[model samples]
Target: MGHLFSKRKSRVTEHDKALLQLKTTRDKIHQYQKRSEATVEKDRQLAKKLIRDGKKERALLLLRKKKFIEEQLKKTDGTLDNIEKMIQDIEFSQIEMQVVDSLKIGNESLKQINAMLSIEDVEHILDETQEAVEKQREIDALLSGGLLTEEDETAAEEELDAIIADAIQKRLPEAPTDVENPEVVLPDVPETLPEAEKKAQKEKVAMAAS
Candidate 1:
């Protein structure tokens, strides 16, 4: 069961098939070139033997054939180079096509997003938000204006003044109450000066009697 599931099916496109055919042809040409090289070397060895045996014409013919095979081998090498270049160009073209397709998709997605969200829509949203804020401001102003009438404000100020005056009165010292009156002593008058005079008269009388 694992083997059955592990056999993953791969998709092969026409491009892949074409590249496979090209590589196969290149491999076949390479193999043929190798065989031709071996044949050329063998023919050269045989031509040397033919020269030693005095068969000059046959050896020259063999050398001519070897030359023709070398020329054909060079042509095959050119074919291989062209095939490789074509394969590389095809692959690079595929990459460029993919890049163009990706850019197209991205451009379409951006267009969709721009279509959904436009400048007008954004401006409308901002206008609504501004209107809402203005309404809220008006509401706040109305409420504040209604709550604080002139009479209420004056009464509140008077009440606050009364509270402040009461606080100040509480901080002052209490007045004195039921206080006693103090006695003030006065100096005596000089109405008793006749006593000194009387003492002097008595002394005079005593001198007369003696």
Candidate 2:
């Protein structure tokens, strides 16, 4: 009975040692699970921070692009205004040039009209001078000829009166058709005495006396 009691006591001691080793292994596994869960939480926080930062950076870039576009639009508007002003200036210059050219043409036309009027007046004066010269020549020819009798003088005076009346009438009116187509009538010639007949009669009287 004493030997049996000692063997039983040794068996109980070996079972106690086995139970302690199992408890220690379970504690070590729990510690390892806790450490893994902590690492996972830390990684999730870092990913959230990265996502927020990326959104902020994109928003800032969009704002900068919008500002740049607005500045470019302002510059383009100013350039367009300047171009419009230049176009207006060019149009005004063209209008002014046209006006100047019109004035110059008008002045030249007026000068030409005045010159033509002066030429017409000069032609009229020359015609009057030629008529006066022809009248003086006719008067001198009549004074130098003594062949004009009183009847011829009277006839010439009547013809002169008619010519003066015609000239006076034509000075302010048109010339007559008969004056343009004048009849050129020739004058009658006188007969001449024969000198040979008188000479023959004288010779016959002398022969009878002999």
Best by TM-score: 1
lDDT (tens digit, per residue) of candidate 2 on 89-162: 65666678669866966677777768768877989999999999988887887777655888987996566545
lDDT (tens digit, per residue) of candidate 1 on 69-146 = 999999998999999998888788779976986696667777777888989999999999999999998899787876
Whole-model alpha-carbon lDDT for candidate 2: 0.57
RMSD of each: 27.6, 47.4
Q: In angstroms, how far off is 69's CA in candidate 1?
A: 0.3
TM-score of 1: 0.48
Residue pairs with backbone atoms closer than 3 Å in model 2 (clashes) = none
lDDT of 1: 0.78
The backbone clash count of each candidate, in order, is: 0, 0
Off by over 4 Å in 2: 1-54, 119-210
With candidate 1 superimposed using the best TM-score fit, by how many Å does residue 80's alpha carbon deviate from the native?
2.6
Clashing pairs in 1: none
